[model samples]
Each structure stands twice: as C-alpha cells, then as structure tokens.
Target: MLLKKSPSNPIQAASMGINKTEDQAISGWERLRFLYEQPSMERDLSRRIINMAFLTGFFFGGVATSAQARETFERSNIGQRFLSASDVLKRQADYAIVRFAKSGFPMGFKCALVSGSIVYADFLKIFHCG
Candidate 1:
C-alpha cells in the first residue's frame, strides 16, 4: 500500500509514494527555531525604561528602609554603643541575660528575649551585618 506524505509529517514522507522537496524542508529543527518576532525599537526602549525605573525604585526602597531602621534604633536608645547588627548580636547577649535575670520568669524573661531577638533581626535586615 502506498503511503501519502503530509507536508507536516517527515515519517510519512520517508515511507511515501511521492516525496516532495518542500515536505523534506520541514525538519524537526524548524520547530525549535524562535517563533516570536523581534520587538520594535519603541517597545524595546520602553522595556528598558521600565526596567531601569523598577531597579531605581528597588534601590531607593532599600535605602529608605535602612534609614528608617537607623532612625528607629537611635530613638529606641537601647544599645547606642553597638553600631551594627553583628555588634548588637554579640554584645546584646549579656544585656539579655542580665535583663532576664532581673526581670525573672514567665513574662519578663520572655519579653526580654523576644524583644532582643526582634531587634537583632531588624538590624540584620537593614545593615546586613556579618
């Protein structure tokens, strides 16, 4: 029996009664080629502008957050001597223990520990301390 080759099928072409050159040209590789058309110059420029704006906003947002954290730290006056998160984490342990001891069980100790941990986390986020 003769197999009729469809232009879209190569296996049919290989076993076909008549092999057309155009059918042979539609290889598996053609499907792998990029299907999307290139962006127009205006579209490309707008994309670039949008990307830059997003990056700029991201940078400024980080800066603003850090500044706000620094202001909060200054206002709190908890550990004025400690400059960064690493310093706070290292030295605050002693303070935490002392406060825990003075304040004692359940409520006081928990409050001291939780507050200290939260402050350390905030400092780490803003300062990216080692």
Candidate 2:
C-alpha cells in the first residue's frame, strides 16, 4: 500500500484545521510564519458598510438612551442618586418612571420615584456602570 505524502506547508495544515500530533508536527515558528504569509480575508464592500452602519446605530442608540435617562432623572427633581431596582421598588414613591437607563446596556429599566425623587432602580443583570 502506498501512503500519500502529507502537506508540508504550515498555512495549509492550519487552514485545514488538522489535529496536531498527526504525523505532521507543526512548530510554533511555522504557525507564526503561516499567519504572516496569509493575506487578510476579503469582505464585500456592501457587507462591510452594513456592519459599520449597524455598529454606529447601536452606539448612537445607547448614547441617546443615556441622555434621555439623565434628562428624565434631572427633570424629576430627584437627587442624582441611583438605587438598586429592588430597593427602589420597596421605597415609598408617588410615581415611577417605569422606563429608565442603566449603564453599558441597550435595555430599559424600571425606576421607582417618590415625590419626584428616584427611590430605586431595577435593571437587567446584563451590565451596569454604577
């Protein structure tokens, strides 16, 4: 039986996702060389533009939400203090915003208010700055 010769190029081996210790032993230096030799993957122009637009939209949306939240909080005449969601709910408040902003997330949260003062903030566990 004649066994076919395996590939000697590191780039070919890595790109194929072949397992290591399989007769073809690729050294670290070879892998780095392969990475340097390979050209970057080309993407379609429209796809790239769409991705950029999506990212920009997401970023601007977050900024807008934060600004809206800050304005709402300030206008309520409540001290610039934020409390936990559960804590806010437990406190005595005449009305609640029901829709508020938490740091670093694109979702809305509920805030309890008492006489225009923020009592507590209930938000998702995704992310929060403070």
Candidate 3:
C-alpha cells in the first residue's frame, strides 16, 4: 500500500503546498522593496487634496446646519412661542454640529449644548459664540 497514493495519508502533500507559498516570500519582499524605494510625492499630494476636500465639506455642512438651527431657536425664543418640526429639526441639526465639533465633551451647556431628549435631561441651550 503506497501511503503517498492514499487520500487518507495526504499530510505530506498538504505540508509541501504550504512550503511552496513560503518559498515565493522572497519575490514578494523584493516587489514591496521596489515600491517602497520609489518617490511618492504625487500620491501624497493627491491624498492631501482629497483629505482637505472631505474635511471642508464636513465642516461646511455642520456650520450650515448650525446657522439654520440658530434661526429656528431664535424664532421660538427659547422654544416657548412655537414648537414645530422645522424648529425641532433645526435645533437638532445645530446640536448635531455642536456635538460633532465638541467630541469627547460632557453633556451640558458649559462645555457644549445639551442635546437629546428633555425628559431625560434638562433644558436645551441654543446659544453660540464667535
């Protein structure tokens, strides 16, 4: 009985296939070394431009929502006069801007506006600073 021909005794074939991939590791390392040695200024600049555009859009959208929220909050005058969906959405959008900007901040007005439900928390402050 030839153990090599037996499917149940295929341990040697499995180990040989694994060693074949390991043998090509040198070629993979050489290819990586070639790329690593080349200049990447163009890639770097393109990456920077893409990053800036993304960040600008993010902050600009946040600021726009904040402004709209401010208008809604002011119209309500501390939300005592009216409480429409637009007003609520405006305040929420503005609060989201503040929350996104002041990440890792506590849930209060001293550090940032109190966002979320009023029943669980206190009043919401719509005030902003220059």
lDDT on C-alpha atoms for all candidate structures: 0.42, 0.41, 0.41
- Candidate 1 vs. truth: CA RMSD? 21.7
* TM-score of every candidate relative to the true structure: 0.29, 0.26, 0.30
lDDT of 2: 0.41
User: Per-residue lDDT for 41-113 in model 2, tens only?
Assistant: 3213323444555455545545656556645655775664557866544442312222321332232111111
lDDT digits (tens) for residues 1-130 of candidate 1: 9984364554334324344475354333221121112333433444455455545554444444554554554567654666788987665554445443333333433443443333212111212344
Model 2: per-residue Cα lDDT at residue 13: 55
Q: On residues 88-117, what C-alpha lDDT tens digit does candidate 3 reach at each position?
A: 667666666774565322222222221211
Error of 3 at 65 (Å): 2.0
Ranking by lDDT: 1, 2, 3
Residue pairs clashing, model 3: none
Model 1, position 102, has a per-residue lDDT of 35
